[model samples]
Target: MYLISGAECFDPSPRGQVDVLVAGGQVIAIVEPGTLNVDAEQIDARGKILVPGLVDALTHPCGGGGEGGFGNRTAEIDVETFVRAGVSAPVGALGTDSIGRSLDVLYGNVMGMRTQGLNAFMLSGAYRVPAPSLTGDIARDIYLVAPVVGVGEVAIADHRGTQPTAQELRRLAAETQLGGILGGEGGTVLVHVGAGDSRLALLREAIEGSDLAPSVLYPTHVNRSTALLDEAADWALRGGFVDITVSTTKELIAAGDITAEQALRRLLEAGAPAEKITMSSDAGGSLPVYVDGELVGLTAASPGSLSDLLRALFADHADLFPLALAAMTRNPASALRLNAAGEIREGTRADLLLLDPAHGVDSLMCGGNWLLRHGEYLN
Candidate 1:
């Protein structure tokens, strides 16, 4: 058992000076400050912040893709980078390339993260229609597969996508949403936003015309283009969550369209609900700068950007309560169906991060185990 005190906790909401107790891999209790008097070792939060560990709701955790043969595929990441970034939980997703993306590979990736002490799960498909499936049907896989949540990153509006018709998209969404209900999880249909002229027309049609609740559509990479980002904001206004990728936001800032700081501010200013926006580092994924279909430049996502986004949010005077932690924690928890995850509350998993609020990650804990202490790995 452990007692973590002296810091405010963010379940994406402010809980002042909470003494969080952990045991048996779950957060057993949250006591009044100084409630526990055991000689049990105490780790101070240092008046910093204690938030439910950040969640990367969407990522290609097993090294995203290889548009250029096996050599082009990025290598899989280990536990160190994730913990360092304050990502105690991650929801893996498959990107555009699907040849090497197999259901078996996806399952192994989720289990591998669990082995290394992370809450891991995955969406079942890439950006294709007749979308890739482990059980031959989206709904079946969602109900039958353990880690499967919903179908995703189904590429729309991009040349790379299967360019699913509105009808096809509707069918997929209906199946996914139903499956999520049956499985008692959120049936989030993932979409990968690309910089195409059509923008989010297909998505809009799906929402406007279909019976599915708008919240079920989880679109990501909104910052890839200014127009796309705006479309994402509109989606949020219409009650859908948007995934603003860290690197894509960086590119936007570089182009003067908006800073990562501004992109967030815009989301809030638009009166979009706070919980409707989430962020992720497409870590272990490729960032290709394509010109005329020739890959001119490419960069793999760095784990540091997630921290950079959070730090930037704090630096920009953004509210720390919901803004700082939810994008990383509760929002993902709600979007993906990971109960007993997200938040620093009773009966939740003990995936936690302790920060200086001024500096950054000082210690990390997962499943009641101190994986990181004083900025160093315990084991």
Candidate 2:
């Protein structure tokens, strides 16, 4: 048992100053400062901020690369990488190299991470049209597999993708919905929006032609281009969700394309509901660079970039803090149906981070176990 005292909490909603009780892998209670007197180890957190640990929804935990070649395949991500980055939950998915990196490998990594004390889940399918599945069907994979919460990271409108038609995407989403209904989870189709000129046209048309709710299709990499970002804003206006890639924004900023801050600002300025937007790190995935339709080079994304982006936002864009925090925490949790995770409230999983004065991770607790203390790793 532990008592975290005198911290400004953000249940991702700014709960002012409070003390949180942790026991048995869950938040036992939240009380006023100095109000709880119990037998527990005392941890003073004066002048610090407490926020929910991040839920990165689009990571490639089993490794995601090989566009350049087999030699260029990125290595698998470690549990410490995410813990140090203040992420307690990481939803794994496959990308372009789904053939080499099977769903079995991804599922294994997810379960392995869980055994090592992380809230890990995974998506089914990849960038291909006929998405590869363990049970030979995506619906069965979601319904039967406990860790398989949703479908995709499915690539659309990209040169490397199988060029699945709008109808095909709709059918895939329907199948995911069916599985979700049976399994009692959100049947979200995590689409990888590419740089192709289609620019979310398929998703919009699918929504128009089908009875699926706009919330079922979640497109990522919406910040890859101005046009796509604009379309994403419109999608959000119509009650759909959009995901911005943290590593992609950083890479684009490095290439002198657009800064991370501006992409989010543009989305908000274009009437995109901030609550409807989410951010993901795409950690361990390949950031493949193409020139005239040829893979020239690539770089693998890392875990800390999501934390880095949040710290930067707190430092440079204070007004976006609440929305940004919710994006990385609560929003993804809700979308993926991660019970008792993502929020720092009583009866929830005790996945919390204490931020130092500089907004960096000072301490981290996942499932009532201390992973980091005083800015040092303990596990």
Candidate 3:
């Protein structure tokens, strides 16, 4: 058992100074400071703040890339990377190079992370249809595979995507929804929105022309372009969720692309519901640069980028910090329908992070086990 005392906790809803109790890898109770006494290791966090561990909704756990060939494939993510980034829960997916990467390998990576004390999940498929699956069918994969909650990172409107038609997308969404219903999981079709000219037209069509709920399709990387961001804001306004990627480079920003923070601000300013917005670190994926329709160079993305963005938001835009935090926390959890995640609540998994005076991660706990303490990896 463990007790965290006198910390300002955000049950993602900001409960003032409180003490949190953890046992059996779950949050057992939360009480006013000094209210409860128990035999447990105690830590005084009077000067710090505590928040639910951030969730990376769209990550390349087994590594992504390969747009530039096998030599360009990204490296697999290690446990320490997630600990340092304050990511306790991560949902993995394949990107452009799904052909080279197997779903089994991705599942292995997720299970490995789980063995190391991180709460992990995955999506089956890459940037195309028919989506690659372990059980040969996307719905069957979701229903039979324990870690698979949905099918995602499927590409659209991108040069690298299969450029699936509206009917194909509708079919994918319908099947994914059915799988979710049958498997008691979120059967989301995680769409990878690209910089192509079509923007979100196909997704719009899929939502309008089908019985699928607007929430069935989750479009990520919406901040890659101004027009796309605008479309994403409108989508959110109309009751859909949108995800902004935090793994953007300065070059992309210079080219008029918005950062995750910028995108969040835009979404809020444009009257989009804050609960409908999410942000994720497209970590371990390749950030390929294109010049005049040619692949010029590729660089790896980091999960820490999401933490960096959050730190900046906390420092510079304190008023927006809760909303931003929600984007990484409650929103993604709700969007993915993940149980006992994205919030620090009793009966939920005890995945939490502590912030020091500098607004950096001072300690992190995953499944009630300390993975990082005082800025050092415990393991």
Candidate 4:
């Protein structure tokens, strides 16, 4: 057992100074400081802030970025990167090049992370209508594959995308939701809304014309353009979840019509529900620079960007810090149906991040084990 004492806890909602107890890879108790006495290892958290470890809903754990060429395919992300990024749960997906990279490879990578003590998951398909599936079917993939939560990073409205019709998307969403229903999880379709004139039209059609719930289609990269961001705000207002991609590269940031910071601000100003918004690093994916609809240069995204973005948000947007934290943690967890995995509370997983006074990650504990301490890796 472990006792994390005298820390300000954010169970994502400010629990004041409290003590949390952990045992057998789960949080067992939470009480007022100095109120609980136990014979267990102690962590002095007097000057720290404890929050739930981040849940990255969109990432490329098996590696992405073959846009430039085969030589430019990014390297697979290591377990150390996820720990350093303070991500306890990461949902991996394929992007533009799902051909060279296969679902089997993605599943292997996710299982590898699990072996290393990370709560890793993956989507079944890539950026195409006829997505590559491990079980030769999307529903079967989600139903039979334990790690697959949904189908996604599927592209739309981009030149590189398959330009799937509304019927195709509706069918995919229906099957995904069915799989989730059968598997007792969120069977979501993670749509990659690209920089095209069609915008979210296809998505809107797919959701509105079908019996599928708005939650069935989770559109990401809504911050790709100011117009798309505005549309995303409307989508959120209508009770749909929208994801903002936090880009680390200057080229990708510039490629977006607005910065992630600006996009968040815009979403709030547009009156979008705080709980319906999420931020992802798009890590390990390609940040390709397109000129005249052609890929001229490419750079790989970093998982560390998730932590960096949260730090920057807390430092600069104090008023929105709580909402921002939820965006990175609880909201995405909820969207991806990661129960008892995103918040710090009794009965929840012991996946926590202890932040220094500067709001930087100082220590990280996942599954009741310390993976990082004093800004250094312990395992």
Question: Which 10-residue span in candidate 2 carries the lowest summed lDDT?
Answer: 249-258
TM-scores for candidates 1 onward, in order: 0.91, 0.94, 0.96, 0.95
Mind giving the per-residue lDDT tens digits that candidate 4 earns over 233-322? Answer: 988887789999886555556655577778889999999998999998888887666777776676678877877767777777777777
On a 0 to 1 TM-score scale, where does candidate 2 land against the true structure? 0.94
Q: Top model by TM-score, which number?
A: 3
Q: What tens digits encode model 3's per-residue C-alpha lDDT throughout 1-379?
A: 9999988888777788999999999999999899998999999898887999998999997888887778888899998999899999899998888768888889999999989988899998889887888998888888888888888898998999998988898999888888888988778988998889999999989888567777888999999888998899888887789999988776778776798877888888988899999999999888767787676878778888877876787778878788888999999988887876899988989999998747588899999899999899987
State the lDDT of candidate 1 residue by residue for 276-362, as single tens digits: 878777787886666666656666786667776776666666574357467767877877767756788888789888876667777
Off by over 4 Å in 3: 288-297
Give stretches of model 1 more than 4 Å off: 68-70, 249-257, 288-297, 316-321
After TM-score superposition, the amount by which residue 106's alpha carbon in candidate 1 deviates from its true location, in angstroms, is 2.1
Q: How many backbone clashes does every candidate have?
A: 2, 0, 0, 0
| lDDT digits (tens) for residues 1-379 of candidate 2 | 9999988888998889999999999999999988988999998998888999899989998888887779889889988888888889889999998878899888899999888888888899999888888799888988899888888898877899998887888899999889889888757899998778997988988889689988889999887778888898999999988888878634465544344567678899999988888888899887766776666677778778878877777787879887888989998887766676789878888898988758588888888888888877876
